[model samples]
Target: LILMLVMVGLLSLILGMGLPTTANYIVVSSLMAGVVVELGAQSGLIVPLIAVHLFVFYFGIMADVTPPVGLASFAAAAVSGGDAIKTGFVAFFYSLRTVALPFVFIFNTDLLLIDVTWVQGILVFITASIAILVFTAGTMGWFLTKSRVYESVALVLIAFMLFRPDFVMDRIQPPFQQVEPSAFTEALGNAAEGDEIRLVVSGPDFDTGDNKETTLVLSVGAGSGEERLANFGLLLLPEDGVVKMDEPSFGSAFSDSLSSFDFYGDDPVQIASVQAPSNQMAKEWVFIPALIFLAFIAFLQRARISRQGVPA
Candidate 1:
């Protein structure tokens, strides 16, 4: 599957090289995107649909600036009297500035605008765009003012922090605090009506027999027992001191969550583990320092530009 991902990405890149924009998108996405989606899940990657499509599309578009047969570079060379190969290399270098974005969205679906609240969407857009600009400034060695080498490096690091502040905090403090399965009964019993119960479970895949892990976010009801579980679309019947999955309501959250894991007829899946969501430090927390650094650079650059009598 890892091989498949690499192959898909490379193939998409190659196919994108000479193809026109719309056709390039249609061809690569139609051919390779599905392979990534299917093989990725089987490989335990579970990348978002939006991310995969964008990933292929990005590489396809990148082909235009790539070496050897780069049409964009040829056009630029024709206009600027430069070698086409050199122009292609230069264009490719510029394109590298935005390459990290696809990988970012692949790991963090928030950047793809998936499952984000309206407020979060706005914040993400603002912070991400600003971070990209900062990164560009660092790479180009210019901002509002010309940047020293060390200052450019610092700006780049600051940009990365603003782009994915949670990355560092996660290493320092893991986001999830494990919950014991033994305490599940108490937790479920005590949960108020309409509350969400998040459970992470791992079991053998019913189809492939491979062990796979998935999270089940079940909703609690106003009542308790089988009735409570039923509210979340689960029907469990006990037979001879053993709990069994009786019937999962079609189109219900229970069935939807359960579909990700393997379940056999009338057999209870052992709960290998559990986790209650823990709030992590907000990514925006790092944005403050990043913005301050950006402002400092801007101030220095503005002063330099003024000294040169450049137009404001």
Candidate 2:
């Protein structure tokens, strides 16, 4: 999965080189977006559509300034009377500082503005912009003033936290508890109200004529596991050590959403893994503290620069 995603990004970057902006996006998105979707499906990764598109598109744009066939690098080199290859490498180094954004947003779709409210969008925008600015400052070793080695490292960490606060929170508190497939019934039966149960399933996708893996997040509400699943438009029958889908409710969310995938095949699907949600401290709890630390670093830098009488 890791290799395939990297290849997708590299392919998009190469395709974008030497192409006009409009044609670059059109060609890369048309050719490479489907590769990401297919690879993501095979890997059981629920990457958002917009995230995949942007991931390829962003790297493609970056390629225009990257090495070998970098048009931007050549143009800049022409104006500077410098080596095009050398300028391309330098441009590539700077672009690497921002390339992490696409990867972070790929894992955390919240950054893509998917399903975000106006207020949430504003907050994400503000935090993400600040995080990227701090990230650039650290990568370039300059902010309010030239950053010390340790300060630059801290700034990078702070930027990552601001961009994905859940990373730290998840490390401190696990997000899910793995449940044995054999004990799935007992776990489901005893699940708490409003809890979410994640099931990883794999089976043949007839539509694509390929084996595919997908994840289903089922809500275990104030009743039996089956009942809550039914609410989400799924019907299951588990007996004699086998689980089968009886049938999805007509016109239901499950049926509508997965109509094309056909995860609920005629044969019993393979249960790859099961995970139950764990109540953990919200990521916001970490975000606020990280933001404060970042502000403190900026303050220290500004004060140091002021003492040194550096020009603003």
Candidate 3:
């Protein structure tokens, strides 16, 4: 997923080069947003459509600071009486930290404050502030004082952990547990409104008659199981001890892509897995180790500064 995001970001940067802000957003959102959404789903990571669009838009705007054809850099250079290309290079260098924000928010939507509680919002604000500061210090090679090579690396790692505690938590405990497809009805019934249920569908392709499988994340709404499924354009029924997929309704989420699946062929379309979110301990525990490591770096930097008699 990260590799795909990086590739899309670079592509957006290129496609948006030398374009005005409005034109840049239009081009990148039109060309790159769908790629992220489709690729993310194929990779079993269902990114929100808005998030994908914002991700591309972020990188698209960054083109102005990139080299060779940096309009923003030229304007800045004209105002500062500096060389345009050099200014572009320096701007791009500084932008590396900013580049990390889109990736961070992609996985940790709390940074965007989506679906967060008041307390959670405060915590997110605090951690995000600290993370950004530590990240900036790491990238700039300074923290309290001059940072050693190792200290800078540690600071960056600490910042990442702070920004995304779930990355560490996931290693300890997976976020979602795979449930049998037979339990889809039960899972859907138990799911709270607005929850997402990941479903894997597989069957023979309608056009090529080849077998294919893909994951779909359907949003649960306030309704019965069948009604909820209808929201995503899915209709599943139990027949002959196997769940069979019926034709999707018009103008629903599954109407377009699910059409390729041969629902009534020899090998019928069926749900392969139903992934339900697992209950786990708060991810904030990872913050302890990250803060400890950050303190260690600060202590090391402080000692170095003292020994060198540098004002900090």
- State TM-scores per candidate: 0.69, 0.76, 0.88
Candidate 3 lDDT over residue span 1-312, tens digit each: 788899999999999899999999999999999888766766777667677878998888888989988899999999999999999999988888767899976888888888899999999999999999999999889999988898899999999999999989999998888887877888887888988888888789898899877788777889887677666777888876678788788788888868778877888888878898878679999999999999988888789888999988
Clash pairs for candidate 2? none
Ranking by TM-score: 3, 2, 1
Error of 2 at 125 (Å): 1.6
Candidate ranking under lDDT, highest first, comes to 3, 2, 1
Which parts of model 3 are misplaced by more than 4 Å? Answer: 192-194, 204-212, 221-233, 237-242, 251-253, 256-267
TM-score of 2: 0.76
Candidate 2 vs 3: which has more TM-score: 3
Poorly placed runs, candidate 2 (over 4 Å) = 1-4, 41-44, 76-83, 179-197, 203-213, 218-268, 299-312
lDDT of 1 by residue, 161-209 (tens): 8777777677766665666666555566666665556665555667777
On the 0 to 100 scale, the lDDT of residue 137 in model 3 is 94
- Alpha-carbon RMSD, candidate 3: 2.6
Which 10 successive residues of model 1 have the least lDDT summed?
A: 238-247
